[model samples]
Target: MILALSFIESPIAVIVILGSILVFALYYFNKKQVILRKLSKTRRKAVASLKTNEFVKVHGKALHVVAPLVAPLSKRKCVFYTIKLEKKVSSGKSSYWKTIVDEEKMQDFFLEQNGSYVIVRPVPSPKNYKSYLVKDEKVSSGVFNDPTPEFKELLKTYNIDSEGFFGFNKTLRYEEGIIEVGEKITVAGIAKWKTLNEPIPEYAYSKIVELISDEKEKLIITDHPKALKDSRHSI
Candidate 1:
């Protein structure tokens, strides 16, 4: 009884717990500071011009792209999608979680302004401009149905334990990020000049359009309409 009680109240154990909490707090605070700084810079420099064949930064609503792909977890049609899969791990008297998958998939989409549009190729994320404005929705709140064949393949790829002697032992948590059609968005990048000879892909909504970025410049897409607050944090 004495050993158990001491273990429960050990000073080192207490310090470790407190230290972990402090570390997480610091990380959260730092992340917020960085995001705020980026937002401020974007707001200061963001433009709304829509002239073609010229490099510009703009923000507008997301337009249709490639018939809109269904988000894996949300089942909502969106141009851009990100999904995260986490697994529960158990240890003696303690448990923790590990991320098994964090992936983003997007089709070539357009950002539309007042009767004008730009083909956005959201490729080659910059080092400092990697934060995207997206909403995360919890699709699986720890409970899961029978794994689909695709999910089974993912399990094999990740080497995750799907079954034990009795039954499934692993708990899966699924969440997704979506940039839905008609949603307000912000974009920063170059507006490439489309050649008269070049033809827009048939999947695109329009043929007359300019590209967002080139090899020299990187593209950034965010849901912060005014670059003030990123809606992703609210979720």
Candidate 2:
């Protein structure tokens, strides 16, 4: 208690701690700005005009070449989905939402534009590329309210109990985002042409092209063109 009071009483110590936090916040903000600038500066291109090894951005309706995934919380069919679980944590006189679980999944999908289809591979390579998704669905449960059976099951899978030690419901929030089939979305990546071994529906071309992230560039598959503005769910 003496040490805690001394640390709080010392102006220099408090200033140094606050300054460190400010510096960290600024650094993080700048890093995200750099990524946003890169995305904003890239010019959007037509699917037919994309060249192999070229970096391009394309916007079109999402088309699933394969079976779509069911979003965990909403059960909606989508090419990509991200779920975040946060619990409220209280300290002294302040409370903050602390993230307990963050999960995201994606599959290959097609981007159709003007009768031309380009495959989009959202899986990041070993080069540390990233995908930014904007979650549009959210749900919350707390002491006065209880989660549904499905929500409790999900929490069980993560080994998190829905109730606290006294059997009261814990304050929790869930956010889910998905890129549904036929949803208009934007993608940016390095384009490459690949020869198809078999034919596929809606596309007659024997040789198909795909957008993927490479060592030099990261693939961006987003439901919103302005996803950088709301990137909290980025994965």
Question: For each candidate, what TM-score against the reference?
Answer: 0.62, 0.78
Q: What shift in Å separates residue 57 of candidate 1 from its native position after superposition?
A: 3.9
After superposition, the stretches of candidate 2 with alpha carbons farther than 4 Å from their true spots are 1-35, 124-128, 148-150, 227-235
Each model's lDDT: 0.62, 0.80
Measured with C-alpha atoms, the lDDT of residue 178 in candidate 1 is: 85
Where does the lowest 10-residue lDDT sum fall in candidate 1?
42-51
On residues 52-111, what C-alpha lDDT tens digit does candidate 2 reach at each position?
Answer: 988877788888878999888778899988899999999999999999998888888888
Query: What TM-score, to 2 decimals, does candidate 1 have?
Result: 0.62
| Overall local distance difference test of candidate 1 | 0.62
The C-alpha RMSD of each candidate to the native structure, in angstroms, is: 7.8, 6.6
Task: List candidate 1 stretches off by more than 4 Å.
Answer: 1-36, 43-56, 124-129, 141-164, 195-217, 224-235
lDDT at residue 202 of model 2 (Cα atoms): 65
